[model samples]
Target chain A: MDFTGIVVVAGNYGSGKTETAINLAAACRKTGMAVNIADLDLVNPYFRTREARIPLEALGIKVILPDRQYHFADLPILSPAVADILRQQSDLTILDAGGDDVGVTVLAALASVLKDKSVRMLQVINVFRPFTNDVAGCIKIQQEIEASAKLHITGLVSNANLLDETTPEHIYRGYDLVQKVAAQTGLPVEFITAGQKVLPLLDMHRFSCPVLPIDRKLLPPWKRI
Target chain B: MAKVLMKGNEAIGEAAIRAGCKNYFAYPITPQSEVAEYLVKRLPEEGGVFLQGESEVAVGYMIFGAAGAGERVMTTSSSPGISLMSEALSYIAAAQCPAVFVNIVRGGPGLGGILPSQGDYFQATKGGGHGDYHLLVMAPDGVQEAVEMTMLAFTLAEKYRGPVMIMGDGLIGQMMEPVEFPDDLKTEPTNKDDWATNGMDTRKSKKRNLVKSLFLDPAALNDNNLALKAKYEQMKKEEVRFELYNSDTDYQVLITSYGTMSRVCRTAIDMLKEEGIEVAMLRPKTLFPFPEKAVFDAAAKDSCKAVISIEMSMGQMVEDVERCVKGQRPVEFYGECGGDIPSPEKIIDIIKGLL
Candidate 1:
């Protein structure tokens, strides 16, 4: 569960990147690793890592963002603290890179800094999303994120979910899609994520990688994991 | 078709295409911008037209132009963008053209935060634009309902020959859920040859079709208003759709809600049922007709003590709920806004306080 340096997560819009990033950070934190997560989802106005900041910070994990004034403004203002996180380097610095190439463009500015650091850029693939519904589509998203982020994706996270209605079938198919993408792209499948309810019913043998239990944090007030 | 996991915004875009609507013109705005993004690629692939207008104002006119020309047209926008299109909506309604407008409303009044809020209830239910007009508004509670409503909006727009709006909160535009596109809901565009100025030669007719909202003379304007009122009356009589939850037996508090807020109230009602407390909910699918009789009957139940309006705004829908209950029971209002959706627990607490 422990990772060195930074783990940047990026994918298409609505691909569960924020949830994956937050869960990944929490998993690392549970393993007694120092975790710092940066909220870089400027393209999305709702369901950002900042919404989970209170809980994440309460868990002793640092949540990085721009100044307090620009907290909820939905501006593409990447804070200097993001660079400092890359340089400061926690045991696991999970940079929740935004959705699509448009959102990942902010990470391009940190290309120079990423070169000197131990960076593991991970692409989250949700076969349920329109653009990334297949291997080709997933690969296209990976390429777009890499091109805009100016970094190569070293791993993939299978985050197939249908919010509240997710099932074990979705997780299995998601893993199958991620495996296909990994086989096509020659990248490692880092982990597969599922909501806590689905995790118990999933056939663990179906997945070759670690399983991350997603505790939804960026949900509306009425929703819960 | 098998159900697929889809975001509300993207599902709405696909619903429009499946419903035989090919023309989509929109400007990018938060929450609802995904609809434009999805259609920008998929529309052309279906041999349809997709245009990004310079602004919401221009986008609104594009819809009016296409709709007036007898084409099935749609545009999706957030609160501020919808406000910009309000003038064109009035024009389209006045001209008696069928146009579907989806307002994935964000927190509002003035460039409010981009989060779920039912603040646009008043704007959508009442005419956002000026001059006596009402856009047949439908408020969907979930992503699946959002898709269904988006598809139904097209047909309702054509049938009424006016603007139809699917008013949803930012959450409806952002959330993900499993949805199925019912093949039965796919409709062929109605024949608009009689009233459309789609070129008389195309319809093989000699009479010229005139489409305009301006009547110049006071008497003519009054007549047009009367005609519009007649159509609205027909809609109210035939298209008042609503769902009653937990009202079969008996309930002390009757909750009047719609869209995302209704879903929350439903969760609260179920949780309270576990605690031996009875609470019923009436969710309005069509906001225009308001389901007045349903609300009235539900409130008139002997077990019903008070009617409460639960919403994500500062009590916008309470006005309609109050009008519907007609003082049969004491009407109460509880709401939160600026992206704050009251939780099931908060609603439970509020309902318990009433008991």
Candidate 2:
């Protein structure tokens, strides 16, 4: 369960990468380690790590985001503080990347800084999404992300969810696909994510990695109902 | 005709390709962004043209230019983007250009939240843009229907040589369902050489053709308006489409709706029927023609005491229902806006009060 150094979370749109990154930051902080999150997702302004800034900051985790004036702007404005954090090499620095390779292209700017550092880039997979529904599809996305970000995916995180209707079977079904993907790609299943409600129902023995219980954040204003 | 699970937005993109529409111009907007995203990759593979315009306004004119050149073209956007394209839509209608515009409507007055809403009914059916013109608007209730109507939209647009709109809410765009775009529904693009702005030198005939909407002379303008009116009347007679449910059995109330709202009404009907309260539904597949006769005939049922218009808007379609009912039966309105969908239980409660 030791998550030290820089950890990056990457996935396709609606792949639950933001939630996974947020929960991963909280998990690292729970171990009494310094945590910092950079909202590197310039591709999607709607759902990004920046939306959970208040709570993460309250937990004593530093959150790096664009200037206040450009908070909602669609343009990519990577604050210099992100590079400073990468240089500082915090205990756990989680970079919540944007949806696809288009979003991950921003990460290439910091490739030189991250080259010598111990970096763990985990590709988050949500089986329910259109493009990443199969093993080959997941591999294609992995290759694309690696090509765009100029970084290698160290492991896989199974995050199969169906929003509000997600069930245990859905999680299990996604885990099966991720396992097949891991077998083909020779990557480890880092962990799986489930909603707090389904966490109690999941069989812990069925998974090889620890499970991360999600706290729903970054929901649309209308979906608050 | 292989069946596959597809979101409504992606299905519309696939349907346009199957309908021989290789030219697409659109700006990305919520709910309908997938259409442009899907086409960006698929169109280039099919040797078609796909361009993401700088804005919806620019995209509308791009479609106009392509359609004027006799190419099958389409564009997809949400409510606010459609509002930006209203001016071009009016000109497209006036010049009688054949193009399809898909509006996967979200809640709107300005830039509203990205959730399902049928608030664009008045805008689509009554013509949001200026001038005296109408775009043949088709409302599809589900993913499968959205695919079918998208394929049909090109045909209808070319048939009358005017703009056609496929209207659906965000629910239709985001939801996934198994669909098949039948090969039989594929249609050949209509010949546009007669009035199309294709270069005169390209054809054997050296007569130049202009596709402008302007009519400087009062007499010529009047004749143009009359011609457009005559075509609309012809459409009213030949193209009104609707679906009737439980019309055969005597019912206490008749619910009139379209698109996703009609599907909710169907569920409410089943729930009410379990309680022994009979209800009927008249779902309009075409919103412009409005299916006035079907609403009037459904309301004419002696046992049907009251008619209700259920929608996801602030009673826009209710006005049309009232117009059709003509005071023969009391008309009521129940709606939810800003992306709040009406539940079947809540609808059943409304039905109970009417009963």
Candidate 3:
């Protein structure tokens, strides 16, 4: 559960990876530690970590994205700043990659640099999403992430949510799925993310891992509070 | 069945399958590729086919080929991809083949941006291709409406025997919301054998149906244009769907908007109502068979002093709003075509300016 060193977060599409990564960086920074979050997502065109850069930067956390030339594109281009941050042996550096194996393939480009440092690669699992809805599906995603990134996943983040309609039961069920996957893979359940609405309603003692209460930053302009 | 949370793109793919459409063809594009990703895995399980063609142009013809044979077919694409499919769309419409095309519109003059935009309003409502034809365009305001409209697209396509479109923006495609697949939207394709090239033996008829869009003779082409005109007219009469928000009370500003843009307007309306400023909104669900009368009537309200077309585009829909209001009330336009959607506060400011 320690938010130290380089933390790489990968997940299936719609697995709440970007939101969790953004919140994770913000959470780590809240402890008075300098945090830098990099957006290496080359898969999704919208609703990525870069979209919330303004607010994240306003929180005194550094937000890195691809160069302005290929910013909106799903190109294989990775910013040099990301490499610089990866080499920085300081406070928390979270990398939010795109979803699925294809999404994390960009991590393989950083594999050479990653091999030099001890990185905590975490796979976010949302049991409600189509691919990671079950134990086998979660394991498959974990294996895919491991294979494509050429790195081992040290932890799992149970991020089962239904946007504005999320309830306590959803978080509970998500915690159960992450526990099952953790038991099977022997990886630690790093944390569980519940949004502002359902955070108060959840029974905190039921979850073994630490809870990260995330403010929904990546939303449509209309839905934003 | 219980409500499941789904991205609008994935919901659209599932809704088509539930509608008994077993054939789907598409080329990947931003904000809408998830529909293809979800269907490529799920379609085969239902004994349906999902094909990702080399290009949107190729995929559009694949849909045309399947629909020409009386098979329910569909394709999903973004703005640029939809533009590539326009030629085939015109061909399919001319041949009277029933097909559904989903344009999860991103910004564009050409590949403008991958964020949500209503720039395709003119492209969808008016003819994108070279023809005197119109697509039955349904604009959904959210993921749930996207699902319902996607399912209904197949039935309406068969009913009119022409292309129907689910005109969604990128936000609608990428965002997640709880949705239920209604059993009522599940429908069998109807009236196909009468005109489709479904084969003589399949329809149990000795006559072989030839599906062609060409009418070389001048008289024949005029008749074909008239027939297309008749179908569009019928759609205007029976299929015009509009939602009047806060219309029961007399409001000053009448907002004409659709899809995700209207959702923001709805929130703004509620916020404005709390401030004792009542503003009504007329949301047109069908773009081609636009709720012109509804818009005019809503604008004609005694207290209504102004009508504004609030969209995610740079005044693409404002032209239609101006025509519908007929200059009775002063018409205004407000938009942002680049990726950032106009916020409710920004919308409130615009509405306040009109007052």
Candidate 4:
């Protein structure tokens, strides 16, 4: 009942950011609040918001993205129209920005519009992935992304695991590492996404910010729920 | 009841509230992001929901889920974001899930520059997503229309149990204008337990409702497509909106336009009229299920030598005008892309050249 504003899911490649984004939007919508997901992942072509457009649309949630262009790969095709939609005073607007420092450029253009808006830009870290395994490495990546996006990283989303074989212990270890990064960066640890099954195993009170139980759908057909 | 000055995007947020909408979800893009920002604080105070989705894809599904619950929900985005939402839009159309969507369009081909453009005409009017479905698309010309159409979008969407789109461009979203909130904005709250999944208790024990677009069998999908086409045909009878200016007079030329481009076209038409030239203008309020009859009547006689389609794109809307004319008169096009708005004087010169 304490619905506030949008929840942004962002991180480096292979961090399962998009999957987290989709699940978070779904969970909130299931609670009877209107939700929208934006596809700002202009880096990789595969597994984007456009792919989920039909299912989301059937549910009546608004999805925003760039039109597919075969001829050009790197045009500043980010539409200002998305900004227009964000200005609406009624709906909650979430921005699924692109991955990594380069992908976060989408937020730079929105500096003026997001000026006074209560926005939270969280950096998602995957400990299993290289270069972000340690607390210092995650903080560095977060700082670089913040600089590139011209926005502050508001919080942390610890989602460290090996796909399909993650354990509750893995979630706890990932949480500890992210807590260090959050302290080093002076950003709060917003949320940690544990597989729905793993949620019951982890102590619910250890972390600050909400703990979101996520259902994975981005993996191959055999791994998806 | 009071008139307030607001940008088009902000107006959409206010208008959605006026229409009794309690939930809104979207992701931030340009031009329309202000709408999301505005609603973040306002919706909570009004006892509503405001959330910024993770991505356009997730934002769209959020809308889908909320509308299935029978809450008056809405979302806003730009051309590219709308492109992302098109798949969801197609499903909403087929499943007859009523909701409102506002697109503040900008230029695009890949990530086309973030300027105003009408390039999405084909996508908006002729179906952007896969599947044989047509959404009821309304194009607002000014801030007032943007607000009014958003309010009306909710009503029409619920009336048909399908998605409604308010398609405008950055010009409308950024412009400031005066507006009057209608005193009588809400009607009796109709229960949609028949299809909406608000709660099981809302309906008597019967069968569970599933709002889905999946039909493994080709025959079932074909039937659904045919049924959608039939509904579109019926909508043609019920939903053709337009505004005619100087059409009553003996016009020498016809101007066709919509949204912000149409407003510029109006300026040129007025200039030409001041010079004792008899020229008229027709603005399409409903971009989809376009006002074909109005177009035909405006270009009725051979007395009108030519028709001109003015827009923000290079010439997207011109294609529709050409179809409407069908060799009845010469049709021409003029536009400025990448947010470059064509001045009225430039449009006037183009009109003079056409004459």
Candidate 5:
């Protein structure tokens, strides 16, 4: 089987990290691969992989979250059970890392297990976030997260958005900012995610790799509209 | 029949297949994801539908939808995911939809640790979700019970037109032990087509079976709840499962425990016995509609001095044990929270103190 390795999604707060993770997992599933998603977003818990579990299960994709006692507003403690899933060779496993450096601490426990595996740790950049508004700031946040996790960032996900009202121009600016940060950090720009409506308007030729589409399912069911 | 060492999580998925459960919907949480991963491939091979739900909230609804169709369906999660599922579990129960839900409990008041813990006993047995309802909860201690109970859960759910829960903990989900699925057992074909909303057929009469928890009138809602309570009372006669160990003598101490913690209690019982202490244990396999008669009988014993409730949480199942033993015996309790699995040695020590 062509193992797509483990996609570790890490980024600053409100960077749409979980959304990117979910949609990317969905994109992979659409290509006829077995996909298993682990909701490791220990940060702001309200919008995470677990929120999308039902639809994912409907698609024959597997989703892993914490148990019932673990609510949305708690620190993420990665279970060793997650390591067992990571070691499996058949499917593509997506780790939807929580927002911010503290949230990424959950992965620090897996440094040894991740050593030989095909793992891609990507840092998502949202220019709208407090500290990571600029290219240098994005790079700085990436270093802080990488230092804390003891893992290098392999790629950059440009998920620039303006909350419930993200426009094509905002996505373009976010992509440009991440492109520069990618150059400085020596990380590849893996994908640029645009709202489904903006997908047709953007120039796909400006970046390398695939331009993954982002649906609105990452939003809370009440906030979806 | 081939028997191999399997974890509680893997056993749940495997048993669902063995039970002829044709549809599975789930969101993975620690200690329980294996249930989902194991089924990802096995379900397709078994000619079943395996869906990775978008969220625990949605997975619960998906199970509700699939079960509503008269298909044998199941979903598994740990504590946090189970919390999200409580709403759906309630709806399924109120709707009398047949399905199986497995909760591999972990420690917590909030995001707690990821180790095995039975903190969800009250939520699970006393109706984790809203409304006046209860799920037919089966607490499995070992891998064999986990697999066997899950299969039984499917049958019981369909038989009662209600939901059944397989409540285990992280230790059970992760621990591996030998399991044997009965070869003579086969899944009975469901007559779901009689009521399932599997697209309209003009040949059938127009009888729409709406599975919802919503009831507009207070009187009707009370009636529904009372009817549900009656159903539970009837279930008490048909489904209360328990295992009595070392109870042949007039024991000075009676230990009531269930699930993974009960396995630890079993070892503790052996140690207590070795020390010339006569102790008896009643491990409840069915938590809800608890083994009341077995507990009452054990408490009525003149030799059984005290009842100590052993659990992984801070005295949750102890409530039910107390309710059963009533004032007939002094019920004591010992436990640890936040994903801590109490050792058999700890239980032995606790028992010694009671003596």
Candidate 6:
């Protein structure tokens, strides 16, 4: 799994895109790549990539969030540092976009900066979600996201999960749905994400793409230490 | 009526649509926001109305106004959002409008954490707003139960001509479970020609109908209060609902719980039974017009040694439990607040201590 250049993770809400983005940044850092993750998610204030900033930074992954005072603000206060990162490409730069077309519209502001670079926008698909349950629904979301973000999705990431109750079947079912989506949208299945516990239980050969094992960094306030 | 896996929040939205509720007005709050999101697209496809109000306070009045005009309307919110809607809820209750409110409650006194909590017990059962009115509050334990309760909420709201509330915790809202909406539960909106403030020309008699909560005269206000009290009393007799688990045989301890906490108690009861500890659970499906008699009867069992109330709050429902026991036995309370769910092992420890 070579995560080079700028990778944007976008998906519908609760599709586990933030978790995938966090883990992808961590994965790139483990390979000695200089990774930086910009929290471009202004849609959801609760479960954004910035919530796991401390540990992500501990992995030597630089996290660029909104201005310090506006960390928890719902406003899309993009830091100038994100533009600097996009201008000077690092080993791996990840832009974790917010959920849905409304969230991805923030990317249109940086579209020109991202236009010249080799950008990979991965649409994280969770078939269990209400809107993206079927292939047509997934395609419709993909088209809307591309139109709003002013960039086409390069690949798909199957992130089918049901929180604590997620099983191997959920992952496989998501993989199958994304495969169909990939066929329809002409995008490759970049990878499938699962929690560290469920990864070993999954048959890796069944999926065409590699499996990215996720570390649970995003937790509710009560679950945090 | 095929079974499909769905989050509790989305399931409740579908259930509302199935129950003939075409109008939905709500502000997005954590846990319950999915209900509004799901309906925003679905209701439009179903030729229904969906609107995200500027705030929960505004959404509550939106529901009241819509319901007053003879539409089956509803709103969904969390704890703090529901607090904002309490004022409109009181107005709706006073106006005798049929509307439904779903509170996928999170922990809160004010701006509390967005996690599962049954802390809104008093707000839903007792009046949260400044009034002496009660909403028909139903608590469902799982996704399927949440759907069923939401459907029932519409009917009960119309039958009693008042607001009905379906209370669920964040766990019930976020969790995924296979649910099938029963086709038999499909319903038509209750006819409101006589009382509803629809256009006067639409009425057969061509008479004007006004829906307002304000009563200028003291006697009229008093009469309205008396009528509401009578309706509440009638609900107490006819609408009290509960379920008894493992109560067929004699038990050493009786546990009282509701909603998601009740499901946790069931798991605890199964664990305790394996260790030769006999326990019975009495779960009230309706919080308002609470199944007080059922709780009293369960606690008064000959073999029951103690009664304990388990909740996802700081002993809110325990007050009701104690009232039911009435010193017949030792009553205890165990709870966890601020989004921390009580584990089955912890519950068993509490039960053993009581024994």
The digit string of per-residue lDDT tens for model 1 on B163-231 reads: 999999888888888898888455555679989989988999999999998899999999999989999
lDDT of 6: 0.87
Point out where model 4 deviates above 4 Å: A1-225, B188-191
Q: Which stretches of candidate 3 lie over 4 Å from their true place?
A: B184-186
Docking class of 1: medium
lDDT of 2 by residue, B1-355 (tens): 4355567888899899988889999998876887887788788877899988999999989999999988899999999999999999999988889999999998878987777899999999999888899989999998899989999998999999999999999888866656767784455554676889888776557778889889999998888888889989998999999999888889999999888888878888887788888999999999998899889989998999999999999999999999999999999999998676787888889999997
True contacts kept of each: 0.56, 0.00, 0.58, 0.00, 0.00, 0.07
**Reference-based lDDT, residue B73, model 1:** 89
**Alpha carbon deviation, residue B220, candidate 4 (Å):** 2.7
Which parts of model 6 have CA positions greater than 4 angstroms off? Answer: A1-7, A18-97, A103-119, A147-151, A159-176, A192-225, B1-5, B184-186, B215-223, B246-251, B270-276
Candidate 3 C-alpha lDDT tens digits along B53-168: 99999998999899999998999999999999999999999999999999999988887888889999999989899889999999999989998898888888989999999999
Candidate 5 Cα deviation (angstroms), residue B155 = 0.5
DockQ top scorer: 3
Question: What's the lDDT for all of these models?
Answer: 0.88, 0.87, 0.90, 0.77, 0.79, 0.87
* Residue-wise C-alpha lDDT for candidate 5, range B1-355, written one tens digit per residue: 5344455677788888888887989886776776776788578887788888899999999999988777788899888998999998899888878988888887786877777788898888887788788888999877788878988887888878898888898777865455677653466546665656655573275667666778899998888788788889889998888999999977999999887777778877777788888889999999887998789899889998899888888999888888888789899999887554677777878888988
Weakest lDDT window of 10 consecutive positions for candidate 2 chain A? A216-225
Q: Which pairs in model 1 have colliding backbones?
A: none
Stretches of candidate 5 exceeding 4 Å from the true structure: A1-225, B184-191
lDDT of 1 at A36: 95
Docking class of 2: incorrect
